[model samples]
Each structure stands twice: as C-alpha cells, then as structure tokens.
Target: MDANEDLSPRVMDANEDLSPRVGMEFDTLKDAWEFWLKFGRQMGFDARKHYINKNMNDEKITSKGFVCAKQGIRGPEKENMIRTRNQDDTRTNCPVKLYVSLVREIGKFKVIDFIEEHNHTLHLSETIYMMRSQRKISKVHARLIELASSSRIKPKATHKLMSREACGRTNLGFVELDQYNYLRTKQQKNLIYGQAICLLGYFQEQLTTNPSFQYAVQLDNVK
Candidate 1:
C-alpha cells in the first residue's frame, strides 16, 4: 500500500466522529473571525485568534484559530471556598485548535485544518455565558421576539416563552435574564419607532385629504 493510503486511515482514526471540517468562506478576515466566534460559542468553546498573516500592504491574508474550554473554578474549588495549596487555580489546557487560510484565487478565507480533541472536561451549563457572543440574542430569536411583540404579547410573557424555548434546546448558550432584557429593550425601541411612523403617516394622509383643516400643536420650551 502507498504511504498516502496508510496515513489516511490514521488521520481518520484521530478525528473519529469529532472530525472538524471546513465551513463557509468569507470575503474578509473580520467576517471570517466573526463567523468562527459564533460557531465556537455554539460548539461550547471560546474561540481565540492565534495568528494573522498579512501582506506588505498590511492586509490580512490568513488566520489561525484556537478554542479552549471555558475557564472557572474547578470541582475542588466548589467544594472549598478558601484556597489551599492542593487546589489548582489554573485553567484547563484544552488542545483544540484550527487553521484558516485565504484563497487568493477565490478571494475567500476558508477553514483549512481543525484539531477537535480537548484535554479537559467541559461544563455542561455555565459555558454559555462565558463569551459575549453566546450571551447576545440571535437574529432568529430577535425575529421571534418581533413577532410576539406585534401580536401584543407582554414583554414579560414573551420573555417567559423565549426562556422556555431556550431551555428545551441543548445547543443555545444564553442566559434567560439576559435574553429577556435584550428582547424587551429591542421591542421597546421597535414599538416606539413604529408608533411614530404610523402617527406621521396618519397626519400626512389627513392633511392631504382635508386641505381646509388646520392642525396646530403647542410645544413646551426647555432650556
């Protein structure tokens, strides 16, 4: 058998079911990084940029990525509030990493390699809030909130429904309180803007249809 065939099986064994594959391509390094950042959050890890390759013009050409288990107090730390010599305060040394490269011919950045093994145990729940991306509301969730708001659902009720939905999903990594606040804030702004636009349109229609009617409003002056 040739060396290439022999090596292929070994590589497959190493990756196993956890084999990492290339994902979507992007036109810019910033876009690529943002995508991976969200992807990593979904996968229950924190993503970091290890390196960046740049051209003479200071343009990003390629990038390296790495992921580590969210760091926090270990099991032993939870048992004992006070620190001791035996309790290790250091973070886990997770080995998962990846490489991304820009294909100049295609004008896109692609994930080139991925090392999917981790050296430490990962938290099942708390990892969701470790990164900012994970805590933020998703576009789909935002749309759901908008729909609920349009239907005259109370913000608190909408929050409860969204929280229940999130709880049922194994992949979403968001805090219920945080998600509620985000949805509420967005809904308020959208409602205010929507009302203003509707009122403006009504006034314009009235003025256009009834030219003889003079509408006046008093304004409070403030320094």
Candidate 2:
C-alpha cells in the first residue's frame, strides 16, 4: 500500500459532536443543523445539500415533508416584531428614516475629514519650512508667500515657521492647493446634506445591532 493511504484524516473529538473551533456550535441537535446551515456559507460548502443528503439517509427524518419545517410553525408571537413599520406614519417613512439613521454615520465622516485636512495643512507648512531652510525658494515660494496673507488658505504666517504651519507651504503646487480646496468645498456640501437628512430621521433603529435578549433594557428603551 502507498504511504499516503496510511495517513489518517483529521478526526474531530468523538465526544464533541459540534466543532466549535470551525464555527459550529450547538445547544441541541436542532441548533447544530441550523448552525451548520449558516456555517456552510463560510466554509464554501452547501449546507442545504448536506442536510438533504443526511435526510435521505435517515428514514424517520425524511418521512416528514422537511425535517425542521414540517414540525415547526413560524411562531405567531415573534411575527409582529419583524413586520414593517406602518407606512401611514409619513413621519417615519423611507427617506426620513434613512436621514435620521445617517446622522451618526455622517458625523463620523466629518470627524475623519477634519483630521485629514488638518494633517495635509500641517504637512504643507513643514515642507515650506524645509525649503526655506535650504533656501531653494522658487515658484512655490511666491505661492506660499501669497497664500500666507490670503483667505485662499487661512491663518497667515507673520514669520517663516508660522507660514509653514498655517498655509502648508506648497508655493504653487497644484496637488496641495487642489486637495485643500476640494476637501473644504466637498465637506461643506456633505455636511449640509447630512444635516438635512438628520432632520428627516432615517436609519434610526429602535434597537442597536446587539441581540435583544443580551441586554436587560426594555423594548420601549430600544425604541
């Protein structure tokens, strides 16, 4: 026999029927199959086919229309929670809902934009300082000197170091100039739109992404 035939397949622990390490966890046999369905997506296996094949091999389980579906109802009590919020409430409809939901998301974008703009400005200033120290002033020198006094940027430098920190020292460099201008313009527009949307109140979930059962908070609190 070939040496390859002697090698054993990786045997999972016999006592541990569900492989938690492989993202399969089960509180019971039914839960194990359910978990297997979800896990199949991650593992590149079709869980539905696996379940079907298993059912085919089992006489009792296959005798039912579908093992789990045959025995279980959708459960009446839980149905109301998943139902769409009433459309009659125009105050809580589509775009308004999206708008409300986006406030936090847009706010995050704003904070990030500020940091990026500030960093770019600081870098420009530093570059100007380095150029002046080296005394390699060129076209960029004229632009930086111009920017130092103008609202085209902001906070003009009275001295060399201040200019570096303020205008970010790209005398006439289009890349630096374009970025500063673009971000200032773009961010304003985005903020205005986001603010308007906020007034409408979209995406406001009564409950956060966390499981309802995980927290002690009441349903009204979630709302």
Candidate 3:
C-alpha cells in the first residue's frame, strides 16, 4: 500500500466537547502530554507532537505543541517507499491542536492556544484503543514478552495470559500486533551502528579477495 491508503473506514465526526483551558500550567513536558492523553481518551481522538522549539542559550524548551495525530496530509517524501505499515493517509489536515510555551520567569509551561475542532471523524470508543497514540507496549510488558519468547512459550498463550490478568483481551489495552511492533522497534535499535559496521567490514573483505565483488547501501528519499 502507498501513503494514500487508510486502514480505518471514515465515520461521522465526533461531538467535540473536552478541551484544555488556555493558560493551564504544567510542570514538565511529560505532565502536559499525560494531560492531553487523558483528554483524548474522553474525547475520542489522539494527539501527537509535531514540532518543538528550544531556547538557544540554556537549551531549555521555548515552545512546542501537539496536534491531532491525523493533522496533516502525507508528504511526497514517503510516497516512494514501501508502505509496510503506518503509511495511511488518515490525516485530513485536521486543525485540532494544543500549543504551549515556556514562562521563563516562573519556569513553568503554559498553554498558549488551542483548537478543538477536528476535520476528520473521531475514533469510536471500541477502536480507540488501537490508535497509535493511545496504545503502547510499556517497559514492564516488553520485558515479559522478551522472557516469554526465551522460554519458547507460544505467543498466543502469552497474550492470553496477559489478557486474563487485565480482566479481558480488550482491557489488556494492546494487541499482539502492537507487541510485535514494539519488539521490531527494539530490535532495530539493538542492531544499529554495531551491526552496520560489522556488515561493512565483511563487504570490504569480500571486495579485497574478489576484484569484481560490489555492494551498495540504500536509503529512503528523506535521507
């Protein structure tokens, strides 16, 4: 699939009601993000940080904001790549947003602006748990998944155990595919520079022994 494909079928727009009052203060970025997450759960939408600005002198935060996860249209840069996952064009240029900035004197972040209107349909309660921003594999669960794999337990069994502990599958707050995605990301990080250098060295040895041996590295358009 290309970036134009949307995994979720569109429904009617959500009744917008929950909103953050302008001038609300937060002690840290984490606090602000958690507040937004709570709002999303109640309002049937998701939020994501799209940009951040920092103070040059102290490297302190100056400004940042979260927008509807489906805030903007996909850019052309991703059009050439294989859409293995998460390339859905669900974004409708929704203007819903929450902007905040630092109050240097008091050293707290204050909400500067907000737009609660969303251009696209809000997620229904049943499916909201599946949204990227709402669901995540926490560190403790990730460790359990790793241990379960080591013990050769069937993945389905592990998932079932977790679901039962959480009271049911839906209450588990994540699915098997979500755990797989998290593991895939963790594996990528573990294979970073160390593996890259080893592979390049192997290729170089091949080139030295065989004159015609050749290799090339590929990167996406953005790189």
Candidate 4:
C-alpha cells in the first residue's frame, strides 16, 4: 500500500464497549498523555492540557488535566448578536474536564476524575486525522520505530509490529507508515552525508601531500 494512503479506521468491535474509565494508570506522564490523546480521538473530540500541577521542591509534575477545546465557547459574537435586543448577555459555558495524577505508592499516573460531556458536535474520522496531536508521534512510539529501523525492518512491518504490541491497550494511533518512511529516508541522507564528509577529508589530505593533483568540476547551463 502507498504509505500516504488512508488506511481503514480501527474501530472498536461491536461486542466491546469499553468506555474511558477513571483510575486508569500509566507508567509515566508521557504514557498518560498518549492514552488520553487516543481516547479523545476515539471519542470524536480533541484533547488538550488544561494545566499541570508540579512539586515545588523537585519541580516535577504531580498531576495533569485535560479539557476539550470545544468545551470553552461556541461563537460568542453570534450569541451577542442574537441577544442584542435583550438586556442580558450570556455566552457559552461548557464544563468538561479530566484529571490525572501521579500516585507515589504505585509510581504511576492514574486518572483521578473524568467529566464526559460535550456541547459541540463530534469531529469526523477524517477531520480527526488532521489534528496536530493525532499526527505527531509520541516519544515511546518514536523509540520503537528507531529500534525497528536499527534492525533493518521495513516501515510497513515496523508499523504492523507496533500495532500488534498495542493490542488490548490504547492504540498507538499517531505512529503511521509515512512517518516511518520519512525517518528511514532521513537516516539514509545522514549516512550519505557522513560518507561524503569522510571522502572529502581523504581528498583534502591527498591534495595537501601531493604536488601533482588535479580536480575537475562540471556544470550544465540552464536558462
């Protein structure tokens, strides 16, 4: 398949109705963020961090919260125009939030609470793909890709391996074959550049030691 081709959406099975649950634990803050991002996409909404609580002494994050972008306001200008005749002016006020916090005992972050509600329409699957977070690869996924690339595995195979590994958990939705291909191509370019540098150094050494050395350059004229 072409790396850019839109693959089929991995929908949940009809029999499986696993909803986002409170107290879901993750190994690290990054893992927590990745899970919630996927959860938001699966639920047809966008996720963003509202705030992060930190420890004063160590300056480490102790808790983090996320909120839907659509939860904030629904076109205040439109609302103001509609209420022009009335004396009172009111705007959209949505209340939806999810909080996750670190548990010192377990050494993992857990969802403390989740307010599952939305005032706006859910985003389409195609539109969700355009979301920045959905398209960006997470740190864990990047590491996996690097490992796979070092083993000389193809991009498609690497993606398949990642998908298989993500089974029964929040899917690694951000890691796409196109990304893997791009990374591989970048690595190839770096290797070529390094080889060229070595060759240049060798030529420079020969030119300095040898008195009788000639180098020729050619260029094509184009209008």
Poorest 10 consecutive residues by lDDT, candidate 1: 3-12
For model 3, where is the 10-residue window of minimal lDDT?
Answer: 4-13
Top-TM-score candidate index? 3
Per-residue C-alpha lDDT of model 1 across residues 55-168, encoded as one tens digit per residue? 778665656554553333357645464354455344465667666777878878787876776666544554545455445555666666678768988766776776665563
Q: Could you tell me every candidate's TM-score relative to the true structure?
A: 0.42, 0.16, 0.69, 0.46
Q: Could you tell me how far off, in angstroms, the CA of residue 152 lies in candidate 1 after the best superposition?
A: 13
* lDDT of candidate 4 at residue 136, scale 0 to 100: 52
lDDT of 2 by residue, 1-223 (tens): 2333312212234463432232222233444444433332222222221122123443323210111111123344434543554322111111100000012222211101100001111113224223211122234444444465454445222334533543544332223444345446656878987986674443234234433523232233544
Where's the lowest-lDDT run of ten residues in candidate 4? 1-10
Each model's total of backbone clashes: 0, 13, 0, 0
Which stretches in model 4 have alpha-carbon errors above 4 Å? Answer: 1-18, 73-93, 137-223
Evaluated against the true structure, the overall lDDT of model 4 is: 0.68
In candidate 1, the residue pairs with backbone N, CA or C atoms under 3 Å apart (3 or more residues apart, or in different chains) clash, namely none
Query: What does candidate 2 score on TM?
Result: 0.16
Kindly list the per-residue Cα lDDT of model 3 for residues 17-64, writing each as its tens digit: 345989988898887887787687767887788789988899988988
- Scored by lDDT, model 3 comes in at 0.77
Name the candidate, 2 or 4, with the larger lDDT value.
4
CA lDDT of each candidate?
0.59, 0.30, 0.77, 0.68
> What is residue 206's positional error in candidate 2, in angstroms?
13
